[model samples]
Target: MALECINLEHVPASHTIHAALFQNIKNASFLHQQLLAGNTEFEYALIDASVIISRLHALAAIYRAVNDLLGNKLRSRNVHSEIVFSLSPNNNIAESFRRFGISPETTSLLVIKVSTPSSPAAGEDIQSHLSKVVDGEQVDFSDGVLRAMTDMVRVKKIYKLNYSSGVNGRGKENAVYGSDRTSQDSKELEMLILGSMALRGATN
Candidate 1:
């Protein structure tokens, strides 16, 4: 199956994370409508794959959301929405949805489902439902796949990492400097993103 079951560290065993990546999605508008209409079956974190950097980036957001859910401090409606919200550097819930969540223009998608004790969804059930509802090609959810799908320009813009005097000052196309340079830059960007997310939580 394309669905990957993840066991996050420091999270309760009762909360399991299931994730999938879809490329060339054909029914983005339909999926977006389902979220807008509050379809219970569509309670998944439908993230725009372009904004995602790697599996770690996505998992970090999932961990934060689930942790909040466990503490009963969720700022959004549920753990699913909280996952998307956790990606933003600010506390603007609606803007977070618009920037990170799925839209009609989204061609690639990162779908995440968190199974909690209150709503225990089996991995098989999630895989089956996703196969039927999401019209796209399911690909392995891995760092390589995610890196290929990432839109660095958009990601830098959203995270405000485009400054000309910081870690990203080397410019977005640092790949020309060699694979090692590219890898180093990506790691720095990931740290900056995580720091921003943590700072937002601290302020709140």
Candidate 2:
């Protein structure tokens, strides 16, 4: 498998590689519903950078395409929207996640994409649970604008891939690589992708 890089910020607004990913999160109610559902993995509400919406959009297609390609190796879970790349006796989960990184491994990693707006407000309908968590930096892209935000994501259970850092934050914190701390292992990454794809305008 080829290594992949996610320009999360460029994702939703990207007409270049992933136009389908961010087609409708802006001012869309259905899209908002989709975002809400995507965030449910966290027992408490955790906000993703705005760019996650775009990543969600692009991965929707990738998930569908890859599932067909791997067939058995990859399974898409609808309830949680995660691409379960089964690491057989020959493979490991960490290696799979590494394949997506500059220097990756054969073990699979869960890529759970989320949707956060350009701005967030209270009472948006989210959870407030925090246990076994870590803080990190988040670099996000939106409509071509590059910026970073201080991120707090859940990290237990996912592996060494925990504690993702920010790339575009205006503050002092630098970016790190790991899982999103919005919730816990109760939800899978693929489920979030499915919900976020719904944030895009519906397909014919």
Candidate 3:
């Protein structure tokens, strides 16, 4: 009832992301790196205990990527970017966007045209608009990273794959960008934000 299923074919705008992004594994590759992060099986294979700590390595890699994105760009006065982490309903893109910063135009709703209608996490249309426009098989920054153009906010997502005993990823905001979003951290983060801005401007 929450508008789970959709048809992307109906949403023409998404087609613009075609080829440039959807054609490669790079866009979504970030997911593969972090999804299976906390399993101790890697360490148990002789020293599986190392698997737990290794999880951070992957996470750090992601942070590094984010750093890269941010370091070179994202320093303008108009750019408002925020990162969110999702843990429930399996931390899929749907849940990831649920916690994302909301803009007036795109409240709690997300439209997707997933082939599997039975998929429990196929995203929901917040307002339940009867004639909601559903877009199919399009480029979405939903699950792992969402980068939006200037208007208001630039949002990214973190899948909380680990917790106390595992990679729960609590307080990710502080962990990633720090509480103030302006605190001094490694030069890596500064460069990452700047890099994001440069990339965004290049696209324009």
Candidate 4:
């Protein structure tokens, strides 16, 4: 199936992470509405893929949120919402949802489902549900796929890595990997984003 079952290290064995990517989403508004209505079946972390940098970037956020879940330190409604909230450099839950979470206009979408002992979801079940609900092309969740969908400008701005860093605000110059310098710059930006995510509440 297109849904990948990820085995994250340092987490409980009962917690299994299932993720999927979708392109050319046609019913983002409907999905957004399900979230707004608090549909229990639609409890996945529905993120806007444009702001994502890579698979690692997304995994870092998931790791943080899952850790929080295990520690009983979740600040959001659940692990799914916490995953979205963990992407922000700041502790604004609502704003994080607006910037990182899915919207009506989101074309490329990232869906994360953490199956816990309490609410266990099989990989097949997740894949089937997503296939029916999300009207989009299911693609492999890979770094290469994510790179094509990333909006570096939005990512940098959200992480506050714009003017302070020497890299240009527009993603074009920094994203070009034809040159070694640009490739290194892109990697540096990913590191910066991870750092920002890691230090989210500590700074404030």
The per-model lDDT (C-alpha) reads 0.86, 0.27, 0.24, 0.88
What is the overall TM-score of model 2 with all chains considered together? 0.24
Q: Count the backbone clashes (under 3 Å) in each candidate.
A: 0, 37, 33, 0
Runs in model 2 deviating more than 4 A are 1-29, 32-74, 77-147, 150-204
Query: lDDT by residue for model 1 over 14-121, one digit each (tens)?
Result: 889999999999999999999999999899999999888778788889999998998989999999999999999898999999999999999999999999888999
Tell me the spans in candidate 4 whose CA falls farther than 4 Å from its real position. Answer: 163-178
lDDT of 2 at 94: 43
lDDT of 4 by residue, 14-130 (tens): 999999999889999999999999999999999999899788899999999999999999999999999999999998999999999999999999999999999999999999999
**Candidate 3 residue-wise lDDT, 1-204, digit = tens:** 233232233333321110101111221222222223532211100000111122222223223323433354322111111112211112233343343322223312222221112221212222222133221223332222221211111211222222122111321333444333323332333234334433432443
Model 2 lDDT per residue over 84-134, tens place: 222111134343222221111111112223232422212222111111121
The CA lDDT at 78 in model 2 is: 28
TM-score leader: 4
Range of the 10 consecutive residues with the lowest summed lDDT in candidate 3: 42-51
Residue 27 of candidate 3: its Cα lDDT? 19
Candidate ranking (lDDT, best to worst):
4, 1, 2, 3
What are the per-model C-alpha RMSD values against the true structure? Answer: 3.0, 16.8, 18.5, 2.3
Model 2: how far is 14 from its true place, Å?
19
State which candidate has the highest lDDT: 4
